[model samples]
Target: MTMTEARPATPLWRRPWMFPLGLLVAAFLAFSLPPYLGLDPARSRIPAPTGWYYPVLVAHIGFATVAMVTCALQIWPWLRQKHPTVHRRTGRVYVFAGAIPASVAGFAIALAAPFGPVGAVSNVFLAVLWFGCTVQGFRTARARRFGEHRRWMVRSFALCMSIISNRIWGVVWAIVLTPQLDTTFGGSEAALGQAIAGITTWTGWVLPLLVAEWWLGRSRGRRRAPSPA
Candidate 1:
C-alpha cells in the first residue's frame, strides 16, 4: 500500500480487554440489580436503617449504574474516535444524569454506612473523589483542554469502576478470613466480618486508583518519549 492508502482497521476481536471486561460488568449488574429493582427495603442486600436510608441507597445505586454504563461508552476508543457526536451526548448523560447524582447520593449514604467506621470513611472519600474528578473533567473539556479532560475522566471512571473491585475484594476477604474468625476475633463472626469489610473497602478503591495512576504516568511518559529516527 502507498503512503496515502488508508490502513485496514483492526478487528474488534483482536482489541484489548475492554470489550470482554465490559461484558463482565454487564453480567455483574444483571445479577446484582434485580433484587434491588423490586424497591422493597426487605430485599436490600445491605442492612438499612429504615426510611430515608433505603430510598437514598436505591437512588445512589440507580444513578451509579447510569454512570457505570456511560463511562464505559465514553472511554470506548472506537465510539469516541468514529462517532464524536455520540461520545459527547453520552458524556453529557454521564455527567448530568449519572455522576453528579450518584456521587451526591453516595456522600449521603456514606455518612450512615452500616459497614462500620473504616468503610464509612472509605465510602465518603470515594464519593468526594468521584465528584471532584468528574467536575474537573467537565471543566477541562469545556476549556478545550482535551488531554487534561481525558486524564480527569479516566480518574473518574476508575473511581466508578472501583465498586466492582470492592465486591471482588470483599468476597475474597470473606473467604480467607471466615475460617479465622474463632482464632482472631474471639469467636465473634460479626467482629471478623467487620474487620474484613473495612480493610477491603480501603484496598478495593485505593489499589485500583494507584494502578490507574501508574498507567497514566506510563502513557504520559510514552507520549513524551523521543521517536526513533
Candidate 2:
C-alpha cells in the first residue's frame, strides 16, 4: 500500500467538542448576518454616524466572518494532517482576505466609536492584538517555527472568536448589573449600558486570550516533561 493509504484515519474522539462548537458558530452567523447583508445602515447594531462608517462597518464584519469561518478549517488537525494543501490555502485566506482587512477596519471603527472612550479603548486593544498575533503567526509559519506558529495562531483564533464571547458577556453583564442602574449608575440607562459594553468588550477577548495562554503553557509543560524510562 502507498504511504497515504497506510495512514490510519484520525479518530473522531480526538477533540470531539470542536464539531459542535463549529456548528454553534455557524448558527450564530446565520442568525446575525441576514440583516447586515442588505447593506442597510439602519440595520446596524452599532451606530453608523458618517456615510463611511456603515460601509467600513460592513466591510469589517464581512472580513471578520471570513476569518472566523476559515480559521476553523485551518485549525482542524484532521484536515491539516490529511489535506495540507487545503489547510495552507485556507490559512492564506484567513490571514490575507480576512484577519488583516478586518483588523485594519476594526482599528478605524474603534477609533471612531460613537460610544465613550472606555469602549473605544477596549476595542482598539482587541484590534491591535488580533493584527499582531495574526501577522506573527504567519511569519512564524513561514520561518518553519511550527511550535511558535501554532501558539500565535491559537491566540489569533481566540481573538477572532471573541465577538461570540462578547455577546455572551454582554447578556450576563446586563442581567447582573441592570438592577444597580439607579444606585450605581445615577439611574441613567445610557450610562449603565455604556459601562456594560466596555466591560464586556474588554473581558470578551482578554479572558479568552488568558485561557489560551494557560492552555498553551500547559501543553508546553507536558512537552517538556521527561518520559518514564
Candidate 3:
C-alpha cells in the first residue's frame, strides 16, 4: 500500500490514559513551577542568580508560565476540533508571549546558572529549540500546512514540558542514587547539584522529543507499509 493509505489504528489501551495523565501532569506542573520562578536563587536550590538576575528570570518565567497553563488547556482534542479559533488564538499567545520571550530570557539565566557548563549547555539548547520549534509551528500554520504545524507544535511543547520532566528525573535520580550521592559528588553539594542538573537537562526535553520522533516515525512507517492483497 502507498503511504497515507495504510495507516494503523491506535490500540484501545492507549486511548484513555494519555489525556487524563497529561492533564494530571499539567496540573501538577502548573501548581509546582511558579514558586521557583520568582524565587531568589540564593534562597532556593537553584544556583544563585547574578547581576540583573531577578528581572531576566522574571521575564523568562513570566512567559513560560503562561505558555505552560495555556498549553494544558489546548491539549484537549475537543477544544481543537470544536474551537479552532480558540486554538489559533491561544497558540499565537503560546508562541509569541510564552515560548519566545521565555526562551531568550532563559538563555541569559542559563549562562548565569551555577549548575556548571553542562547545565548551561542544556538550557541553551532548550532555549534554542523552544523558540525555533514554536516559530516553525507558527510559520507552518500560517502557510496552511496544518499537519506540519501540528507536528512542530507537538515538538515545541515537548520542549516546553522539560521543566516538569527535569524535576521528575531529579526525584527519580535522588531516590535511586541516594546511597551513591556522596561517593559520586565527594560530599560536595555543588558537585551533586551539577550532576543532577546535567542529567535532568538532557533527560528532560531530550527524552520527550525522542519519544515524539519515535512515535512520529512509527506513524509514518505504518502509513507506508504495504498492504496484503
Candidate 4:
C-alpha cells in the first residue's frame, strides 16, 4: 500500500485526553513557577494605585488559577467521554467558576493596565474572545453538533492558554533580550520589560487564535462540500 493508504485512519495515542493533560501541566507550571522559583520579576512592576489594586491583583490571580484548573478538567476527554453526566456537571461548574470570574477580573485589570490603552484594549479583546468561545462551545454541544462543539472548544482552549504563554515569553525576553534593548534605546530595564511583555502578550495570544480559526474554518468547509462520485 502507498504511505498515505497504509497510515491508520485514527491513531490510538492521538486521544483527546492527551491534549488537555499536556495543557494542564503547562498551566500548572505557569502559575506555580513564580511562587516556587521566584523567576518572574514583573510582580514588582505592578503599580500599586491604591489599596484596591492589591486586592484586585490578588483576585485576578486567584480567578485565573481557578479558571485554568477548571478549564483543564472541562477539556479532558477521558472524563468527558467515560462519564458524560459528570462531564456536564463539571462543565457547569467550569463555566460559572472559571469563565465568568476570570473574564470579569481580567477586564478590570485590563482597564487599569500600565502598558497603556493599546495593551488595555488588547486584553479586553482577549477576555471577550475567551468568553465568547466558551459560550459557543457550550451552545454547540447542547445542540448536539459535536464537530462545531469541538471547534469552539479548541478556540476556547487556545485563548485560555494565553495565561500560560504570556508569562513564558515574558520571562524569556526579560532574561535574554531586555539588556540589549535597554542598551540600544538608552532606556530603563522596566520600560524594556513592559514593551517586550506587551508585544509578546498580543502576538502569543491573538495571532495564534486568528490562525487557528482560519485553519479550522477551512477544514470544516472542506468537510461540508459534497464529494465527487
Candidate 5:
C-alpha cells in the first residue's frame, strides 16, 4: 500500500448501534446490583448459593460492566488511528479493572448456579475464555504486537457481550422461537425454557466469537488484496 492509500473505512463495530449496545448492557449490569445490594438472597438473580457468593457476584457484575464499556472504545478504529495512548489506557482498564476479577467471581457463581450441570459447565467455560482472552490481549499489547492485541481484544469483547446475548437468546428462543419450533425438546414448555437456556449459555459467547473471527478474517483478506496494476 502507498502512503497515499487511504486507511480502511470505519468498521461496523464503531457505529452507533454497536457501541451503544455495549453501554446499554453496562447499564443493565449496573442496575442488576441494586437488587442484591443488601445481600438479600431473595432479590438476587442467581440466589447466591451462600452468603459469600453475594459479594462475589457484586464484584463480577461491577467489573464485567467496566469491561463491557471500556472494551467498546478499545476497538474503535478512530481511537487506533488518532489516539493510541487512550486506547492503551482503556485496554489496561478492560483487562485489570474488568475482565480478571469478573472471571473469578463469574466462575464461582457459575459453579453454584441453580440452573443445572449443563448451565454451570457452560458458564465455567465462558468465564475461562473471558479471562484468557483479556490476558492474551494485554500480553500482546505489552509485546508491541498491536495487531494481535486487537484480535485478542475483539475476542475478549465478544465474550463480554455474551451477557447481552444470553438475555436475547433467552427471550427469543424460550419466549418466542422455541414454542414455535416444537417447544417440547422432549417435555413441557418449562422444560423447553430450561433446554433453551442451556443451549444459549454455550452458544451466546461461542457464536459471537465465531462471527467476530469470521469478520476479522474477511477484513484482513480485503486489506491484503492486491492494488490494481
Candidate 6:
C-alpha cells in the first residue's frame, strides 16, 4: 500500500486510546491504593510539616483526585471528539471543580512539605504552572479559539498527570534505592523512600512541563507562519 493508503489503515492499538487507557488505569490505581494502604490524609505519620493544615490537606487530596480523573477523560481523543458537548462541559467542570481547587490546595500543601523550602518552592512552581495553563485554556475556549484551547488544555492535563507519575516514581525508586541507602548510610528504609519521593515529585512535574512548553511553542510557530500559495 502507498503511504497515504497505509496511514488510514493503522491498527487500533496504534491509536490514541492506548495511552488514555494506560493513564486511566494508572490514575485508578493511584486513587484506590492510598485508601487500602491506610495512607489517610487526615493523619500523617510524620509530624505535620511546617504549614500543614488539616482542612487544606483534605481539600488538596479531594481536588487532586477530581483533577486526575477528569484529566483522564479530557485527554482521551475518542471521548473528546465523539462527545464534544460533554467534553466542553466536563472541561468546564475540570477548570472550576478540579484545576482551580487543586492549584489552590497545591500551593497551600507546598508550604508544609517536609523537604523544607526547596520542596515548597518547587511545589509553588507546579501550582502556578497548573493554574496558568488551565486558565489560559478556558480563556481560549471561550474566545472560540479551539486549536489554541486544545493545546493549552493538553499542557494543563499533562501537568496533572504528574500526580500519577510522582507515585509511580516513588514506588520504583524506593524499591531500587532503599537497599543501597540502607547499606551505605545505615539509614532507615523509610527515610530513603521519603528522599526518593521528594526528588521525583519535583522532577516528574517539571520535566513534563518543559517538554509541553516546547511542543506548544513549536505548534504556535507553525500556526502563525503564512502558508505558501
In terms of TM-score, which candidate is strongest?
2
Winning candidate number (lDDT): 2
TM-score of each: 0.93, 0.95, 0.83, 0.74, 0.82, 0.73
Model 2 has a clash total of 0
Query: In candidate 4, which residue ranges exceed 4 Å CA deviation?
Result: 1-12, 16-20, 23-47, 143-146, 175-177, 182-184, 218-222, 225-229
User: How do the residues 1-229 of candidate 6 rate in per-residue lDDT, one tens digit apiece?
Assistant: 0011112333446576667666665756575546424446445533555444655766776777778777777765555655667777778788899988989888987877665555578788889989999999889888878777888887897788776666577677667777788575477665665567567778778777778888888988998999999
Using TM-score as the yardstick, the better of models 3 and 5 is: 3
By the TM-score metric, which is better: model 3 or model 6? Answer: 3
Error of 4 at 16 (Å): 8.0
What lDDT does each candidate get?
A: 0.86, 0.88, 0.76, 0.69, 0.76, 0.72
lDDT of each residue in 125-173, candidate 3, tens digit only:
9898888988998888888887787788778878887788887898887
Clashing pairs in 2: none
RMSD of each: 4.2, 3.2, 4.8, 6.8, 4.5, 6.4
Per-residue error for 115 in candidate 5, Å, reads: 0.8
Model 4 over residues 84-115: C-alpha lDDT tens digits?
A: 67767777666677776777777877878777
* Candidate 6 lDDT score relative to the true structure: 0.72
Ranked by lDDT, the better of candidates 1 and 4 is: 1
User: Which scores greater on lDDT, model 2 or model 5?
Assistant: 2
- Badly placed stretches (over 4 Å) of model 2 are 1-9
| CA deviation > 4 Å runs, candidate 3 | 1-22, 33-47, 226-229
lDDT of 3 at 201: 86
Model 6 / residue 28 / CA error / Å: 4.2
Question: What would the per-residue lDDT of candidate 1 be over residues 197-222, giving only the tens digit for each residue?
Answer: 89998988999899889999999999
State the displacement of the C-alpha of residue 193, model 4, in Å, after optimal TM-score superposition. Answer: 2.4
